[model samples]
Target: MHTKASVQSVADTARGIVLATVEIAARPEHVFRALTEPDQVVRWWGSDEAYRMTNWEMDIGVGGHWRSEGRNADGTSFRASGKLRRVDRPTALSMSWMSDWDGGQASVVHYALEGTTRTTRLTLCHEELVDRPDACRAYAEGWRLVLGWLQQYLAPQSTEAFFLLRLNPPRPNFSEDMSSEEVALMKLHFGYWATLLQAGTAIAYGPVADPGGTWGVAIVRAAEMDAAWVLTDQDPVIRSGRGFRYEIFAMPQLMRGE
Candidate 1:
């Protein structure tokens, strides 16, 4: 299950860059259709609690124009439009994005897809908002939620399994006193798992208080153990080049009750 992730992309709020990535159990061609095709875009573009994209217009080409208009949950109206900057069917698309809710200015939105018929990795990058940090932060959550909508629309039959992640720090008292760099890395690690938790990739994760020593533990869901390894490998602690390690185990049987 430890095959590499489709894309190695993360969001940088300071840079006004937001990234939302997901691996769908479908071909890129099919996902691309759902993304660019006008008829299908209306099917999965928004949320029921918020605003649903009720109208869509698309000119499918580089330098083409696309627009979407919808009403907010409170019945207020909103609209967004963009000019296509690049188009690579089933692979990528880039455009100049501007929406009423997005600072009413031109930013950039790029979508990259990589995969086969079994599973496809999709990544969305919303960039060029250096002047609007709030928008950047909001888009971080918005894009992830939007991706969740797209995944549900695809109706995938993922090979999901429960994984137990035993996180080991360098020393016994590492948690009590971490270095400055370690603290910063912990922030990134928290954000990483927080994103996953919101996206439904993680069930629960936090520091563990052990009698002998304190460590960390994360229970996540992935297609397989290799994929679980991929998830752990991306953690800030594991990638910090420090001596942080994770022992992964599979939960063969997970019983849930009310």
Candidate 2:
């Protein structure tokens, strides 16, 4: 499951700035594109349902210019313009943001993305708001909601089926006493499943400490049984020439939150 986005606000009353952070379930490139790409920006930039973005244009490079015009629910038009100071793909973007409502006042907005392969932590720092501290606070809240929408937009689609995966080995007394090669493959197996867990594909996965014999169990979400099987088939353990295999069972319903 995608976790809730985290929003942090650090107010420097001495300098007048606000910093916010949020984690997204998508990769850095995807997150960066969503922030820079005009089509994607319109989908989540504003919070109000009646707020309509009439125009969004971005040059998206160092020294480039960008502008967006939108109308509020009450039909009040607003325009924002910015000049890109830095545009490092998939990592950071720095720009100067100005709004017509602010009487041509401007602030520096910096977005930094950092995380692993499947997850991205976005930190947005708005600084140089020497005159508009209230705007700084309002933008902090606005970004919190905008990033929440981005997370939902990037979440995986609902699965058609959930499957229980049972991993079987050739031997019954398998443990740390296995061959060095086998142990290495097992580590890879764990990492593989960990990735699946991070991607929100596997609901739960771990080794079962059954007294009879230990095995692996995983609950996977997929569109079809074959898709679920494909994940197991590609497991490092199964591909290591070890006699390991999997059986899958369909689960029609899973109850949660009683």
lDDT of each prediction vs. the true structure?
0.80, 0.77
lDDT tens digits, residues 31-102, model 2? Answer: 887788776677656656646666788997799999999988788999989999999998999999998877
Model 2: what TM-score?
Answer: 0.58
RMSD value for candidate 1? 20.0
Q: Give the distance in Å from residue 237's predicted Cα in candidate 1 to where it truly belongs.
A: 53
Q: What is the per-residue lDDT of model 1 for residues 156-194, given as tens digits with 9 covering 90 to 100?
A: 234677878888889999988998989999999999999
Clashes in candidate 2: how many? 0
Residue 13, model 2, lDDT:
43
Candidate of highest lDDT = 1
Candidate 1, lDDT over the whole model: 0.80
TM-score of 1: 0.57
The number of the candidate with the highest TM-score is 2
Ten contiguous residues minimizing lDDT sum, candidate 2? 151-160
Residue 245 deviation, candidate 2, in Å? 39
